[model samples]
Target: MRFRFVERNRGFFGRVAVAVAGAVKASVAAIGVLALSASPAAAGPTPDYGIDFAIIGDPGNRHVNFDEGRRFYPPYAHEGFTVGTVNYKYRMSRTEITVGQWLEFVNAYRPYYDGPTNAGQFTSDWIVYDNSLGRYRAISGSENFAANMGWRFAARFCNWLHNGKVMEQWAFENGAYDTSTFGRDDNGNYTDQPVRHADAKFWIPNLDEWIKAMHWDPNKNDGEGGYWRYPTSSDEAPISGPPGTGETNAGTWNFYDVGSYPHTTSPWGLLDGSGGRSEHLETLASSSGVRLTNGSDWGGLVSFDEIDRTASELPISSRSGLRLGSIVPSPPAFVALLVVGAVVAQARRR
Candidate 1:
């Protein structure tokens, strides 16, 4: 079920006379960024299941803290690691996967659920199975709350979306990712794949995608660009409070509904990137079991607003939510790039 990502090059540049191949590569890379920035991809229409996304552009952009000097509270060694460089364009969910959206997935996938028990499938506190209804439902007012179903279930959710929300066993197992690799090896090391297949339609955002969504601002540094210290496009930490009262929900005791702070957004327009629920990223913290998570939860400290901070969690840990990433629309990578060029031209003319 593994697929290779096909790299496509447009011959629009005709020919290059560079002596070094590396120079040609650099030149093409520059063109890609210029093309994408001049005409950034538009966020696709919301899907039938209702997950809206923010288009992240500016391919081949530089990473944050490239020299690795950035540090924050506690200053874990890995905290200094550089991130945010991504070479392709994709869309990231505007908010963490919400309870209502997960409910739709739960009802669609429940009839085919063959797991030993559904106990670990969701955060019992927010979503629950009703014996009378024979389907899962989000608790009373938690419909818009961020769902905390851990990493593996989140992967399954991606698989479901990749399969177009089909109500079949295979749809919940394979597509964007392979569930067969979900098991551990003889030496007790987890065998789950570290990333999604290249041809996937939708999957969990990797650490780079997550960081770029939360911090990278293309218009920064007088349009030359740079990353922000926080997801709110600001260097200062956000103020915490309930909906409409603060810039973020983190460092506060209560979990407000997703999008409670519509004005508080990442440079790319993603909401709740700093608080609400820590996001489950596909980047692995360790091969044994730990996976990487980004941002702070509703009860996180003020320092969690720092973009460099991250936490490690087991794949089965249900303490975090997730965000999905998808190629512009369908496959054939160059088509998406072409769309970017078309949009860019329109914007420039205006």
Candidate 2:
């Protein structure tokens, strides 16, 4: 009888151990599922900066003719007669880089120009951070408004994004910017142009890229396609709103919230290509080696045909901003699934 009792006790304990182990394995598998669901691969190419990009397919044979200039004025000798013929496909940001996005870059990298890093500098003049609010707010009551910054500053922002915002080094191997190309003076001021890497993941769009994305309509001109006279994707200037309203109007021509003008869109569905803040382009002026800026800003004369090639040397007060372009690969969904499977198998083995 004693032997039988001992055998029964052992069987009960063994069953309990099995049940506990099974529960543990089940718990681990559940955790793994949760991790996979929250993984970055599952989320895809969602940047922390809240910037969205639109894919631009190659629109073959689009060009602008400034020689036979349109209604406003005759073409200047400096303005090029033709611009286009970009064959490579690329992606462009859907909207200008907003003040909110700039704040994110500032907060993360804390660049040299940030007021706190240097004395006698003013933050409010550029961006205002409200500690009490616990949120970075735009000073001009337009958080969605495009950021106005210098060309060098904009270049650094692109570098920050390229390095995943972790590297302290300004230029890293396989990085976006080639620091060697950056010219510096005796005072350590950057005097020369910063050259972008040939294989950069992100960069400011060149003149051809910008024009093709903004003005080219694939179905226009009997399907042969041609560049629009204006960045509104129309030959006509956009109708503006009343004064003091800060809306799109003939008089104000002020920058509108991105995508507010539903009628204005590129062939690839990019908004705010025109009638927003002037965007810095990667193209350099041959005469001055200054970077080009395209499109007219709000509160300025609307001339889609007008190109500010000397925008790089423009004062800080100029309402110039940047838009990013890239061809980064999308996250692989299959890889995420495989990771989940592997995790489950390991848990079962244990």
Candidate 3:
């Protein structure tokens, strides 16, 4: 993937201004513009699955397992306390998987449907099985809504994408995760694979990956490293309301359209990390029988969506949403992009 460097102002006001009214459209356009430039692109081209991803490039950054010494009412979980600290680079979807994206996967996989990972269950009632047509369709006006699916189904979606999105049964079984590992052992404990294969190109984000994307800022502390209190890139609590009325369309009674709050974004330019829907992580919760989920749904309270709050649910539960994680493109493309980025930084200083 060839790319040209698009120098962006990393200042606080600069980020806010870029994320105004037409944010989603502008972000997509910016991705395209990066690809058209002569140097290596910072992010890869939008994949065939149509999920645009943001590049998380800070490697070997230290982790912040605690609450930065803030002794809030509820203490931090020091047991699984690690946050950020990824030694390698990766990319995460800018927003949760939408109903339309799920529908396309369902149609392709239906050519050879398996008993499990039902497409109908992937997005609540927004995606329904059309008996007459022998396929699934997205509800009117729900094509862009974030999808909530079972963790297993989300894993299979990653498998399908990793295998080039083929329509065969094998394509959905094993690529990033092994479907055969989706059973419990004789001890009655869940026996799913603990992590994605080393060669995995796409898979569910683990705790580290998800937290880093939502919180880590490479430019913090004179480029040493830092994290935000919330995914909206602000330490302040977001006001609850409809799009264009608040920093985030979260902490409300209903779900807002995905990416509706164009003004909210993480340091890496990811959207809806706090509101929208709580997303599943491959990391297991501290509690047994549930997997960890980061962020909170639209209906959650202000404290529920804070960076310190981590939610979890049963793996079979379809309550959590999906965010696809992927490795950065080939080394040559990434290296070229970085070189160009450095040159641009130097030019800006002059």
Candidate 4:
């Protein structure tokens, strides 16, 4: 099954933009400074059942490294559970992660940038929070809460949870700075532990996968006129009246938190997969040589449909976080023996 994302351009949403040229190119000098700490322990398996997703079915690239630079189409596009060079299986969970859970990772796995209150989150300087509004607004210089977090923090968290050790070591040596005296090392480095990259233990969900999970209109071909007003279930513009309400006439209206619908679920029961944050993805080329990154962040605004973009799309800010699903291996059952006449005699001897 697949999904289609729609957008209401009447709003003045200005997403973060990246220079396509700079984004596709590899910059080693900036990577070290750009890097941040990450650590994610195994949360265990998500118990996979052989249930096929039933929703819209339709169409939809990858590259890595800097030899010729990474590139991708429909950024953040990827294949899930490949079947002989094709992604035929669904690859995602249906949920928009909570701030509390992310806080745990920030506290235990990567706590270097934990700002003022020892919350162990990003620097508050990056964004602002309105308790009354219960939402995050862009700012800078480290702050706690989901809104202040940038694409960097989200990406770091994904790496840690997936391949804890490799991603963690890279960050500690690169982005992290010593903070606590009680947790110092011989070289003054905090003894931050590392996690591994064993499959997608916990990685960001792609935009398309997210769309499939959130409000996948089964009628894309069935000929229903719903969700045509906004992206998926998002009806109202922003700041005020929720998704099902009337549009606020774009610019005159203000932007609200991602997936404010509160009930935005795709055909597979996923939440805010497309709206909340810009989801990052790793793509590969048919040549088996390069990998590229496509993202949902787009400086904050993005849509599942190519025709939904409000402004020019960029590659930067594509970094986002992810949730996980599980599949467990079942044990075989043994058959019982009918009758054993000799068993009784052996018991009497004991």
Candidate 5:
């Protein structure tokens, strides 16, 4: 009987030990799952060339009333008196295309354009070649400055971005442009009026779209929705200077870095819309087939104070820059949570 009791006790202790070990393993697995679920998933790697965009939502079914004559101090008639409306919502780049981003495009498409030799000339005359660095660099002080390119070049840049940078499929195909939609001469000049595709992934913003994004105020006039006189989210003009300087001047060359003036953002929080580089608009002027440019540049006379619009008859020599616009998808809140849950489950399994 004593031997039998000892064996039974040993068997019971062995079973208890096994149960405890199994419980500990299950607890560890549960803790890992809880940790992953409680925390957000790690963000994906940043793109080599990424443009941060601001999502502009529709403002209670309202339209912008744009009239340069009434809004401007001297009653300028360049943009003309017009009422604008945007039916759908879109996203606009927070800042003009930066030198770094443009450089990536030039390096990717240099072989197709004119090989690596002429890559320096692809950006602008301002970009200088550095012998020591063995690469083209924007002027030392203008690293984050907006790129100065023509309308056609800007369009091609959009196409390059759409074609995934490595492939030259969309805009200029087989060492030539898709002439059925884009009109190009043998000399590589855009001969006809450029028309954007209906379902283009990325393109320049049209006049109405650009104006609305710049000035539309959804919660103005007791929430009835209205437009600001200027793009600075205020009736008064924007004061420009280098980033972090709080000085105001009508003609100060205050071309601050992108999104430097958070207070002077548009109604939808788009930065540098009023002061920086004059952005190219896809809209063509009525009389001339040339495209139009909006906003004020660094060097201009009260251009920052007004909704300035300049028609680009000569796009080649123009100091115009580009701000890309796109239609991006926004996932629902619950869907985002589910995505996180799935990621956590996968991590726990691993």
Candidate 6:
């Protein structure tokens, strides 16, 4: 696969690319980081799935699992969380939540939580859900969880809700659904608002939803199928020498930028899921012993080939950061146009 980054940002992207290669050389893999869960969610739990519907083959194969010695995995980790009101059936919006998407959340609650993860889940003091203020604010969170990393926050919200917990923390704090609404006896005075799903974008992924957004399909069938890390998965740290190394299939590849290999992208054209960070769907494990605390971040997404084989055996925050997971109805037209322009511009220069 080939990717042509814009010229103006080529230098910057180059630095990022180099750093990614360096990190992969050191053998750090961006698995998945999600907040920990403590209970077994309902038997048939469904998370708040949000994203452009991609026709996934088997998304759960790469999802988290538990080792009670019974080997249990959710239908799809995305299926663990849920959104929309009880009466509303949600249809995921295509595309990931972009940087702009989370900013809305950050800005909306500025008066409440003013912390500085950049996504606005905290208050100015950088604390999370500070209770003393009797309002929404950030408390001093050191561990990575929902909110800051973007997509992981989306996944975390779903994980929390799938556990049948207080999924309405944000809305309740903002007074969107107050006591009057809960105890409403006057049907005539109900506000002209439609019942929103919890956090509006949280839900589980059906097989189709997962595959399309991530754009992954593995030929290896390692467990369910080979765990393709992300788009730049194959382009990561170039294999320095002979075979038997984990970075390359033949172990003779070389360093390349994330998503630089566009050919590896899914047929639907999603990039970097195999060689980059593993986007969070939900929890990796409900066991306190094995929980992921952060979402897949940019650093994680660039070097898919560098990961070790124990992928099925590690904890999450032990993973990486998050992305702007979206629920957009379709891949944005602009993305394709942008890629075409990048490719053309690079070729012309040559």
Best by TM-score: 1
Backbone atom clashes (below 3 Å) for every candidate: 1, 6, 2, 47, 1, 82
Cα lDDT tens digits for candidate 2, 120-202? 12222347656786544566666676676766566767777766776575533235665445564576454444456765667
Each candidate's root-mean-square deviation in Å? 9.2, 12.8, 12.0, 21.4, 12.4, 19.9
* Per-residue lDDT over 10-85 for candidate 4, one digit per residue giving the tens place of the 0 to 100 score: 2322110122122223232233222211112222333332222222222221111122111222243243322111
Query: For model 3, what is the alpha-carbon lDDT of residue 21?
Result: 21
Query: Which segments of model 1 are wrong by more than 4 Å?
Result: 1-48, 66-81, 114-120, 330-350
Q: What TM value does model 3 have? A: 0.76
Flag the better candidate by TM-score, 1 or 2.
1
Residue pairs that clash (backbone atoms under 3 angstroms), model 5: 241-254
What C-alpha root-mean-square deviation, in Å, does candidate 6 show against the real structure? 19.9
Instruction: Please report, in order, the local distance difference test score of every candidate based on alpha carbons.
Output: 0.75, 0.58, 0.72, 0.32, 0.60, 0.32
Using alpha carbons, what is the TM-score of model 1?
0.78
Instruction: Indicate the worst ten consecutive residues by lDDT in candidate 1.
Output: 12-21
Among residues 3 or more apart in sequence or in different chains, the pairs in candidate 3 whose N, CA or C atoms overlap within 3 Å are 3-39, 3-41
Regions of candidate 3 where Cα sits further than 4 Å from its true position:
1-48, 65-80, 111-120, 286-289, 331-350
Q: Compared with the true structure, what per-residue lDDT tens digits does model 1 show for residues 1-350?
A: 12222332323221111112334354457656544543133323325366787779888888876432165322544544557888878888899888888878777767766654456545434877778887777789989988888688898888888777778889989987898989888998788878887667788888888888888999988998888888899888888887767888787778778888999898999999878888888998886867888888888875876777788888877888888787664333455455555544544454
At residue 127, what lDDT does model 5 achieve?
66
> TM-score ranking from best to worst?
1, 3, 5, 2, 4, 6
lDDT for 181 in candidate 3 is 85
- Taking the tens digit of each residue's C-alpha lDDT, what string does model 5 give over 24-109? 45555664543333212121221324688776766234544434325422355445445446666667888888777777666555
Give the candidate number with the greatest lDDT: 1
The true-versus-predicted C-alpha distance at residue 310 of model 6, in Å, is: 7.5
Error in Å for residue 192 of model 3:
0.9
* Candidate 2: C-alpha lDDT: 0.58
Q: Which is the winner by lDDT between candidate 5 and candidate 6?
A: 5
In order of appearance, the predictions have TM-scores of 0.78, 0.66, 0.76, 0.39, 0.68, 0.33
lDDT (Cα, tens digit) per residue for candidate 6, span 1-350: 33343443355456454443444333222211111111111112333333233323332334322321011234433445321111112233223333333333444434543334333322211333435654444333321222233222343333333334343445423222122222112542223122223342334332223333343334534534342333222324333222233322222233223333334444345543443234433333333222222212333322333222112212212232233222222223354445545544554454
